[model samples]
Target: MVTYIARRIGAGLAILFVIAALGFVMLSINTDAVVRGILGPQASEEQAAALKADLGLDQSLPVQFIQWLGGVFRGDLGRSWFTNQDVNELIGLRLPISLSIVIVVLLVTLVVAVLLGLGSAYFGGWFDRATQILCILGFAIPGFLLALILVTVFGVYLGWAPVVGFTPITDSLPGWMRSVTLPTIALASHSVGAVAQQVRNAAFGVLNMDYVRTLRSRGIPEWRLVLVNVLRNSTVSGITVLGLQAVGLLGAVVLVDKIFAIPGIGEMTINYTVRGDRPAIMGLILVLTVLVIVINLLVDVFVSVLNPKVRTR
Candidate 1:
């Protein structure tokens, strides 16, 4: 287990290094833009030269990369060219909002989806069919459109939750939750449908397996068979789907954040991209790339640990 963990950590670091290198190249190679932005057109030739020298824009790519990597090692993701603030500081300030929102959203979807799915699978009839129809609609709706409808209907007309803006949790936890409730719900809505349906489908499929048939033939109690074996087997499929869906959630939350005016990582990323802020774009891309890669690696480890065949292989 220790060896496995070490291997994964090593691989993760290597992947991050690669991502950082690529992102730096993307940001650095745009020399013209960097020059123009850093030194306005009004600047004389000597002023531009001095600015380039101070910023190390004239340095070799290899030297700049080494310096950047060292900063990253020290948890200094460098300063954003546009914001002129430390990248790590910016991310740190916004991370809590996004992280907390994600947790709540995931909880809402997980609890609701699992209950509906398991119930639907265990008792296949009218209730199951109704949930199935709802699940289809859930998967069909675009995230942005869902946010718009929800904000317009729930926030604007109903006045149940705030229409926009995030409030610090330090001020009031209840008030903060009230503000972010819309964004989180919007983020979790589609996931609920997809996860619930997947769980239901997997559970139902497992119910028809040969082992289940044998258990029934042996006069085993229905409750034990369904609760233990059926649910366990079904999780393989359900969890797989859930994991994939989760990877995109960070990037996909932009529209939802816009609707609720949540100052989160997604909001920062989308806003920066819209403004064509290359440093912000490259930094965010690298951050997200590392996150996605780490998640995939964790998934691989999880699958290996869960399945004997995979571990041995």
Candidate 2:
């Protein structure tokens, strides 16, 4: 198990390195444009040259990459080109907000999806039909559109949740819950359906397995058979689906954060991208990449724990 986890971590680090290099190359493509955007049109050539030198853009690409990578390893994300604020500071302030929403969405998705999937598979009647219909609709609608609808109904018309702005959980628990609830629902709406379908399919396959029949023939309690044996075996697929959904949610939160005025990394992403703040944008990309890697790593470890066969592989 330790070896398996170590291998997974090594692979995750490799992926992070590759993604970081690619992001740096892509973002460095228009160095002149970045300098111009930072200094504005009226700035002299000498001013632009000095700005480029200050930002280490005047160095060779490899040199700059090495320097940036070193700084990242040292926990220094540099500073915003425009505001001169520490990129790490900005990310630190916003990351928790995004994470809070993501964590809530995943938890809700897991509970609701497992229940729906298990019920549909076990009952095999109207419940199954309704779950299928909901899954279709979930796939049909986009997350952003769902976020908009949520904002309109829950935030605007009903006044249940505040339409704009967020309150940190550190400030007030209830306020934070209210702030995140609608956004969580909007993001989880689609994830729940996808995960539920995966769970239902996995459960069905498990139920049909020879071991399940043997356990039944051995007079195992129905509830224990379903909950212990069936549920545990079915979880691998659901977990894979949830990991994919988590990555998708990282992108989906951009629109949801915008609609709800949540001050998360997603909102910061748009603001920096639009302004061409290379440092801030690159920092955001790095943070997001790391997040994706960590999430996938965690998923892999969890799957290995639930299925010892995975560890041997």
Q: Residue 248 of model 2: what lDDT?
A: 97
Model 2 agreement with the true structure over 118-216: per-residue lDDT tens digits: 888888899999999998888899888988898899888999999889999999999999998888888998999999999999999889999999999
lDDT string, candidate 1, 1-313, tens digits: 6676677778787887787778778667666566666667788878877867866778898998888767667767777666688777787788788777776776787778877888899888998998988888887888788888889999999999889888888999999888878777778778889889888988888888898999999998988887788877776655666667677787776666766778888889877665555556666766777777766666667766656465544
Cα error of candidate 2 at position 247, Å: 1.1
**How does model 2 fare in lDDT?**
0.91
Clashing pairs in 2: none
Tell me how many clashing residue pairs each candidate has.
0, 0
List of clashing residue pairs for candidate 1: none
lDDT at 195, model 1:
84
Per-candidate Cα lDDT values, in order, are 0.76, 0.91
Q: Determine the backbone clash count of candidate 1.
A: 0
